[model samples]
Target chain A: MKSDMSTIVKTVTDFLFGFIIIFGIYIIIHGHLTPGGGFQGGAVVASGFALLFVAFARTFLDKKPQQLYGLFESVGLLIFISLAFLGIYRTFFYNFLANSGGLFGMKITQGINPGYFNTAGVVPLMNMAVGFEVACGLSLIVYLLYRGVIEEGEDGE
Target chain B: MKTAYAVIFMSILVVFLFTAITTLHPMGYPGHTEMDDYFIKNAQIEVGANNVVTSIVFDYRGFDTLGEATVLFTAVISVVALLRGVKKDEE
Candidate 1:
């Protein structure tokens, strides 16, 4: 009976985590259509990971050193800036990938509505870039707090 | 001890009540309004971006996006500096 109960509890927790992750991804992708954006959605997704870490008492994030988070944060920022510059040069805020256009003129639209999925110019790419930065930045902050490297009295705390 | 606890609880209740009452009050001024539907009518032509929010953020508010990126860079730099010196200190 105890084993069965434990299995049920684990199943419920897994379902909840999966649901949160999926919802977060949906929010990130549809940011242009709604009020939510990459920061909010990425934080939500990271919270899902945090929930899993807490429930399982596992060192899920400890496998990677802080340097990896730093690298991701930097790269995400770079991608975001590059996209902005590309926009400036290409008719200001022009999402170079939204239409049936790519570097090699590949049409990834797949005949979907221009306003539908994968249609918003540069918005999806920006969302993804911001999501990567925010997720890594927030996770790294939390990890530092857990490791006692950052004190509660710090400005962010 | 009993008196102190009662005082603390009463204070908490009072604060909560005050907040609830203040929040419930209706503020003055429904304010004037205007009907500007230029963008709604020609969103694609005006912004050239299908998503209105994207047009606003990247085109209308492009400078704001640059500022936000600068802030993120500053944050990342500070974090990297904070995490750098632990090994030297330990030795």
Candidate 2:
């Protein structure tokens, strides 16, 4: 079936998808200092992909196999759980790297001030992990749903 | 008669919803705020993050987030399984 939308949508998606993805990444990485975090940012990125799916044909995105998304989803979850387990010796989900002068370790003054990026310990890492998981999972779902519709259309024809 | 009954039911429902909305606790003034106070005061020092909500979600209350991730994974798995046979020729 001809699934692609009009040229207007395609052009808009081409211009906007990159900015959307970048904004989502910013939200995910700066989650420690900002309002949005993994789930929110991932949803944002997946929405960008959804725009692509709606604007383009199935063949456009079919270059990559579906399993690749599942792999990313699994890897993201693994990163999250492993990060949680790493702090098991101290306690489950302990802030092991906070204020330790390690990677993502930076002390802040105790009052309201502009927060540094290289701080917050495992929180930012976990944000990235969950961000990856949510983004991949949502995009996979959208892709499958659209493919199902396309398959039904073909069968009907 | 049916129209009268429908209007009466809708009026009662609207009254109930309006009362509930009007009686809600004022924003940022919950009856119990000790836990909120603790989180607001100590989240930055303990988690070293400016965003208290992120710190709480990722660090203090991480188990819940784990459950949330599992739920998303399960949803994706179910979708993939259901859609596996969509196009056998392509497979």
Q: What is the DockQ of candidate 1?
A: 0.15
Error of 2 at A150 (Å): 1.3
lDDT string, candidate 2, B46-80, tens digits: 88999999999999899999999999999999989
- Tell me how many residue pairs clash in candidate 1: 0
DockQ scores of all models, one per candidate = 0.15, 0.74
Span of 10 residues, lowest total lDDT, candidate 1 chain B: B29-38
Best by DockQ: 2
For candidate 1, what's the TM-score of chain A, rounded to 2 decimals? Answer: 0.68
Which residue runs does candidate 1 get wrong by more than 4 Å? Answer: A1-13, A56-58, A90-92, A97-115, A149-157, B1-38, B44-51, B83-85, B88-91
Best by lDDT: 2
* Per-residue lDDT over A48-112 for candidate 2, one digit per residue giving the tens place of the 0 to 100 score: 98888888866555665578889999999999999999999989999899999889989887888
lDDT of 1: 0.64
Candidate 1 CAPRI grade: incorrect
Q: How well is each residue in A1-157 modelled by candidate 1, as lDDT tens digits? A: 1011255556777889989989888877777656677778878887876565445433443454578877987788788888877856566555565544542122332222444453456666787788778777776766555444323323254
Model 1 alpha-carbon miss at residue A48, Å = 1.8
Candidate models: Cα lDDT each: 0.64, 0.91
What TM-score would each prediction reach against the true structure?
0.63, 0.87
